[model samples]
Target chain A: MISYLLRRGSRVVRIILFISFCNAVLAEVEIYGEASYENRYFVEEGLFGQDKSHSSFTLSPEFYFESEDQKTSFTFKPKIRRDSVDNERNLFDIQDFSLVKVQDSYETRIGIRRDFWGVTETVHRVDIINQTDQVESFDGEDKLGQPMINLSLEREWGTLDLYVLIGFRERTFAGEKGRLRLPFPIDRNSAQYESSAENLRTDFAIRWSQYYQDLELALSHFSGTSREPEFKAALKNNTNLIIPYYEVIDQTGLEVLYIVGGLAFKLEAISRSGQGDRFSAATAGFEYTQVGILSSSLDLGWLFEFNHDDRYKDSPIALGARLTFNDLYDSQILSGVIRNEETGETNVFVEASRRVRNCCRLSFESVYFNEGTNSNSVQKTFEYLKQDDFARFEFIYYLGN
Target chain B: MRKLFKHFLFVSLFIFLNFTNADDFDRGLEIALATDKNFSGFGDSQTNLKMLLKNRKGFVTERKMKMKLLEVPNDGDKSLIVFDSPRDVRGVAVLSYAHKVGSDEQWLYLPALKRVKRVASKNRTGPFLGSEFSLEDLSFQEIEKYTYKYLRDEDLEGKGCYVIKRIPLDPYSGYTKQIVWIDKTDSVILQIHHYDRKSFHLKTQIFKGYKKYLNKFWRPNEIHMINHQTNKTTTLFFEEMTFNTGLSEKDFTQNSLKRSK
Candidate 1:
């Protein structure tokens, strides 16, 4: 069976390469991709009751095509990842596949695409477009492409975007064998949606963004199935089990940022109402940078942010906090620093694993879960991560960036 | 005989009046403004380039990037620079909205994070991509950004050129002053001498091997900048270039930076 699976994987690779070659030869297309290996070492033996060490390799390729006049363009990107310790944790995703046509001040796009809509880094409370590709990383920076018909109009005042999301994709979770995953495997096949149409439910969103001098502001509203799913208890084979439940939700978001001198202040806030009741969340932060320090061409920067959320879930009090599945850790703060070297285009940064480089980069990062919070909801929700405050060392090698 | 005297008087007066008028607007400022005015009207441009960085020991490294620019009327232009080569930074892009006043607005897109980072303009003088070119050097240099003083006129390889000294108005500027040479015939910049804060000659940038595009814009084939203190050099070679691409304000924006290929 293993050999057969390997053969299938190779065949899939060959087919993709063939298609990529044809695209290169047939049209005005440019290819970009990266292959990297990440070796992560958890400080404890089993943070998620799994392994102490984990390693994964990913190969991502993107094909970008444009007309000679650049009036029309398209981009298709696909990624595949394989974990050394768990075949079940291997994953593949069509990160972005979109065709866009630009007409004067308006542009229209149709297909699967990703959109980001927040300013704060510690927590992204307002960026809610595509479902999180959780299996990709813990930071949730990676996202799955969303199917939509999008229209964006640009004016001197601001940019307005309208989206018709045609289909919903369930979020991916790390397999049970993965260390950074939840305690139990999230059964994607048995997922349920509150909408009768389920995954076929149509959704809509609108956003307006503008920038004036040092300030950036964006506001958006989305009515759709919440990307975050709550678990519903059931009896499977006479044993208690839980399946993911997607709730229809309406969310309004706001983001603001200002830059002055070497300092930047940012904010992201979201208010949502749906199956789980109405709640609000916010994250605010500031980043200050010192340039060319000590007469050298090096930049040193510091970042600090506060994250907050009201754990107001209406999934019924009987279900309790363990299965409510709300993102309410009450309040927490994050702090870190970054160092950039201009001589070699190298950046050595700590705090956010958003840190990536060409040759190689090593990082040590830690985030406190703040388990001893005073709120009742916070205490119950963070019970699982009581001992989760631990440091991690990640070393990545760029096979081809 | 009376008609001849009248004609001579008119001719000499015309010469004297023209000379005074020429000196009316600070000779240095006129030349500086002329240099910028002569190169205007490139509505927008798309350029594929290769940057070669050489260390003092003669070892060389290279990076490939594409630049897209849009000219804004009555304001500075907007530019988006996306790196394509060196594998690691393939999808990295930087968008800059240069202005006639104050610092420019810039954002950087990191493919790994799939996010755009707002970059402060305070570090504009830092080296770009580990090369001799500073991010500020790549921006559209407006006449209002500096104070110019006319120096003298000299011949550079049989070409008569006007020399001028300019001090940056922006406090973040790394240089104390820059001596510039502009070709008298075409008003194109020939060379520049950059001075450090301690009054030391730091670097020299020579623009050579020009090619005229559309019979109006004088595009340099190669820009060579050498660092005197470090004995290092960086050269930029334009490979594929197109101008007046009909790209409007839409293509040079914060959203476009993330979508840029």
Candidate 2:
């Protein structure tokens, strides 16, 4: 299977090279590559019933090749990552091969990659995602096998930029089945019982930006449906589970005042359909950043989210701050609090990171879950997590160019 | 008889003025070339240079530099310059021809991985060592790179000088035009103003503290360039300069790049 995949990859590379050569005949060609390595540690508590820590290392490499003529250009880029943790490893790959043709007043490009869309910057970024051979589930026991195709279009007229996107996916499941396979039989024929599923999603967004200015305003809406068999089976068990659902996510935001010696600000708001549904959440946030003495910079941000459901209502607030010294060293601190009225459960968390150098960095994080009672304020009992209670460290180094 | 005599005088005066202007232009070009030749002799046969760079924001960084110059006797007045600076750079060399068909050929060696990479001539305008000086700035350009015009006589730093304007013939050049003040007495360039390709004022380079060598060469011990847009400046200081150290062409080849001391 690996050989077959390699053969397919080579064919794609050959096609890219041929196109690059043709383009180079008319203009100059430049190629470059970069590699980076990262080590991360994770510690989680409360949900899984135990406090466990795991360390992992990941290496990522990206290659870019471009050919440009007087009026036209083509660029091809491929990014690959190898991630390993505790004697297990996997690969993550993403490629963007685009041909851009420019005219006097218009430019167009066709490629398989992420699409930047919408006023909220999230309403219309639907793109094809390949899930086959992808490691799924925390235990790495289940694999998601499927390939998805996504289409998107965007245009700018006057001060408004508009975008739309549609995505379709087909899924198949693979794994060793136990004797009491609740969903299906535990045999090869049962594996054959797996069928292809289709999903359709759409998003619309509008953005207004000023010419030669930093301020921009955008609003967007997204709605989608999932008809995968696995989800359908789960819904069959509980009729309350809805499969063909629609969501109306509205977001409006602004980015203001970007200059060398000035401060900048960004604000965003998100509103969804019904409370407690799959995508029913409302959020508002703003960030401020400025550069100061000796080329040092600082940023601060705050966000608040509200969710309304049949059983309870939830409100969450988060605050973050970052300081950068020169371009090499930086430090960040973040804190968040989530409160549910019905369940009386409040989760609070804090995280921070500091860069030691260009090649190394350190991070610290902690979380405290408090169960509050509405009846008593002074005599309220709560549970909390501490530093020795739950935290991790990470370091990164870039190796080659 | 009187009318003919008067006409002859008028014609003679016009011819004299034109001849003098042409002579002034030729003299200016000669002075510029002579000044450049004298400055090129200030460097050692092979030497290393180090500098501390400070940005406008007060960030400081260190850079180590090495330069080697070779003169070709049999290859039609050719010269080679090799430079190695900070940032894993090794074996970066430039081959210049007093008369090449198009432009000079340059190659850079990456010491970290032990590889020699060729640089395209079209990128001559790119910065060298992250400074205002470009690769093209170091190469010897034939008279064709610019069309020199004598502007007028001027006094610079208590020295009699001829002010000349040079307009680039090649569109790819970084500068649209350059104005140079050349000292007539010592045949040395005192100062230069480099304009952008679009004719916008860009930067000024000032040469000072000249040290006479061998009683024949006048070399500037210091050169400074102030960028107008960025409000930043870079200064190059020459130390331990020597001439006639017997640099040969064999020291400039691709094979010699790796073997350099």
Candidate 3:
């Protein structure tokens, strides 16, 4: 199965390279990327008999080409990760392969691409264009490339972006041997879809964004197969496995950011239909920064956010701080805590990183989950992670220019 | 009768001193306006820059970037800086819209996340790219951002210059005042001595290798800044500075920041 996936991945790369080769005759090409080694140590062993520690290596390289006039450009990026313990944790992806053409007042991009939306730091409720690469990180900040044809129009009123998405990418999950896996293994091949076309369903999205003096706002709507899935327990090979069901969804999202002085107020709200009910969710917050704090070249930023979901009984509040040492090494640290309102469960995470020499970087991250006394649904969903606290260290060596 | 005579004498002296100060202020403003006008009407410019940052211990690191600037008719210039080196920050760009009267606007583009984030421009005192130059030091010096006073006339590097002291009007400025030397020949700034907020001599920036472009614009090919307090230095070397690049407003917009290579 892995070999088949690798073969399919290579085919996509070949097609991209052939098209780029034809364009390279008259274009200037630039190549750059990084190779990183990461190690993760779990404070406690997994309840499913996982290893105490795991290591991995990742490589992601990018090639870019631009015409002499700068009116046309192309980018191709592919990433691969190899895990030391779990096969399911391994990954291979074509993150970006897009060709862009610019005109007087408009631009168009075609092929697989990754686009980001929303502005909040904690949770991104409106950034739903791409599926999450769960095995890479649980924060959902990592995304899989989506095949799309995007058109962007610039007008006096605002900017409008229209997207015609071609296919769907299901979220990757941890296997049984993975540290963050659920109690039962997930059957990767047993995914069911509400749409008859399944992974081939065509999706559509549009976004309009504008900035006025001190405020920036965006409104976006997407109608397609949902990036999120519901799990159903099924008996396969005399063992119970969780099967994923992808449902059709229509979602509308709004993002607003108001900046005044050193404080930034942000909001990301979304209304979605077709899962179990039409539900509304919002994450509202503010980030206040004290630059050059305490007569030193250090900036301390305070983040406060309130997250609400109509489908869940919990309204979690997160508090975080980001410290940037405006030093020679460009050191930074971010730490946050989220407390569940109904269950009293807490989640704490910290990330610190600094540049090493000129070509390398070192980073450390740790995540801890404190259990709640109540047996609420939100707590139950995260109960498995209570003992899966882990600390991770990464060393990245950049290459090329 | 004697006390009244003394009060009148003091009042007259105060009026005379005020009159002399007003003349100095007008002359300072006139010189600043002349310098601003001398560099005007270059429509746009594109330049490549290499920055060498040295620590107190003499360890040097290099950073490469490209700059595009659009001269606004009456307000502050719009500029975009794209980093090309220090591999981790490659493709990261900063877009700035500086105004004459109020605070400047800035945005940062992070290529890793494809995020164009609005940055608080009030942090102008912070170092840029770990270099000796602060964000404020890099921006175009709008005439309205400071109030000036004529200090003296002196010769710098064998060229006659007008020495002036300018106090920053921004409440959050890192420097209390700056002493600037503008060459009399072309009105180009030759050097500046920056004073910290505590009234201590902090840094000195020297502009060298002046070359005339289009016979009207004088640009310095090299800028060297030294921090007196930290004993650190940063030198900027410019290359291929072409003016009138035909860059429009569309090129400096937020969307363009994402596409900036």
Candidate 4:
């Protein structure tokens, strides 16, 4: 696969050279690049003791070259990072590299990637995974090595759009003994499973989006299976619990005289099914924006969710609220019953951010999670505040024109 | 010999009248400014004005406005006007002065959204209502905005006029330069050549259908600007203009911006 990709890349380069030669008589080629750095700190109190801190500094650089005619363009980006914890020392790593091409209004990209998904915005990092555990779920540092290929195409028609993506990966997983045991019951030792071998996998996804004035609707589907033994084992064990799901998100909003806005409606359903069992969830919510009496913009929203499982004959309901001030401060509260067994859970979180300048910001966040039992309950809380709070700062500077 | 002397006298009288009229070109501009300056002279006077604004696409729109002049000056020399029409923008007002450096403010009340926004100290060369009429074009021509050089006597639209070229003094002005044709009869501006910042001829504004506002002041009821490059046009019609109704500076304050109507 590596050789094939290199051959293709060389062919593309040759084509670009030919095109440049042909256009060299009339126009000049332009190359541009930009670089930025970000420092993030996370503090938490729970699980593995009272105080745990993770700090990472990241550098992202991108380059692009275009023909004078501008009909064709190419872009490349490489991300690198350095991380430190407590005062114990530090480590460096390379993340991934991406390449993109554009022709007219159509664009094509292939590379190891990270993307945000879902109406509620979930993070999904493809291919590269050095750090096993992180909230954003991707390696914090650049590895310079281990990159995957990702391809995507998108087209628009009037107010409607269609997008498709495909990804290829070759990865290795640790053996099943010790810390690598399967999380659930599965045929981990089967001949079909190779826990510590090189593997290949493919993922396919499609999305359709349509808009009418202020109303928008989106429907997307992703279905792919990986061949890695660990993944296969995990899938087999959770087959009953893992369902192939589809989601429909619809949003209708209004901007009253370009101010004092409000949006009403529901996220009808997200349903999944596997074998003979079916699982589904639905939510409805309303949001409003108003000038608070204190001369600040305030957003208030409420949501309710209902979930059902045919195999377990379980049904659950959840309620949530979100309040935001000046779009910079936000607080959320959610409580729900997990199953017909009446397993209850509640979560609350608040975050605030202040812009130091065009390129810098200061932020603070805290979260609390509680699990309720028939007779007793357990609770965990996490909070993170910038230490220098007053002195800690980030700066983003641009180079070139 | 006596017949020859009589003929020469008649020809010389004709020449003297023509030269005097030529000299009165600036006087006409002065009269036009003075007519708009006197507030009490115009009492309940109504007139219809037509405006045409053009872009690259040629004639884009035409507006017909009815204007009512209320009061002139204390001695009844100048006037104030109010505009009414184009349902979306009915209660808009403008106060103008013939003098330079004096505050000439405009207030607009949008009834649909129930808010009044005051236009304050804007660049004179900026477009009015997204049209080619710069704020400078609407306001009375001030000497400070431009340095005028009298060119020569010429004929435009069948009227004898003094052609003068003016270079704008404002460094940030949208127009690099301008040329105006002032009628020798009443100081009426008949045509103007507007140049872009790059010193390129961008547009031309023409004035016509002159009417005497108070017998001494001739105001053009129709004006048209043709964008040479874009071939588009925009027209503003002053439906109703009332000169003076005891409008005070207090009415132009920020507190009144949200409640003008």
Top candidate when judged by lDDT against the true structure: 3
Better model by lDDT: candidate 1 vs candidate 2: 1
User: How well is each residue in B1-261 modelled by candidate 1, as lDDT tens digits?
Assistant: 999999999999999997776563398898887777645788899899898888888978778899988888888889999987656567799999888888889999987666777887876776677778788787778788998877788999889999989998888777899999999988889999998777799889999888888888888888999988778899999978898787877788766876776
Q: Please, what is the TM-score per model? A: 0.82, 0.41, 0.94, 0.38
Angstrom error of the Cα, residue B214, model 4: value is 38
Model 3 Cα lDDT, one tens digit per residue, A102-159? 8899989999999999988888889988988888875778888999999998888999
Off by over 4 Å in 2: A1-46, A49-51, A70-91, A115-197, A200-214, A221-266, A270-282, A289-312, A327-390, B1-261
Kindly report the fnat of each predicted structure, to 2 decimals. Answer: 0.35, 0.00, 0.54, 0.00
Q: Which TM-score value belongs to model 2? A: 0.41
What lDDT does candidate 3 reach at residue B72? 89
Ranking by lDDT: 3, 1, 2, 4
User: Which should have the higher DockQ, number 1 or number 2?
Assistant: 1
- lDDT for each residue of candidate 3 in B1-261, tens digit (9 for 90 to 100): 999999999999999998888888888888888888655898999999999999999999999999999998978899999999888888999999988888788899998888899877766787888898998999888999999999889999799999999999988788999999999878889999999878988899999999989988889999999998889999999999998777999899877898888
Complex DockQ per candidate = 0.21, 0.02, 0.68, 0.02
> Residue A145: error of model 3 in Å?
0.8
TM-score of chain A of 3: 0.92
User: Lowest-scoring 10 consecutive residues by lDDT in candidate 1 chain A?
Assistant: A318-327
Q: Which candidate is the best by TM-score?
A: 3
Worst 10 residues of 3 chain B by lDDT: B118-127
lDDT scores in order = 0.74, 0.45, 0.88, 0.40
Report clash pairs, candidate 2: none
Native-referenced Cα lDDT, model 3: 0.88
Q: List model 2 lDDT by residue over B170-191, tens digit each.
A: 6557788899898887777788
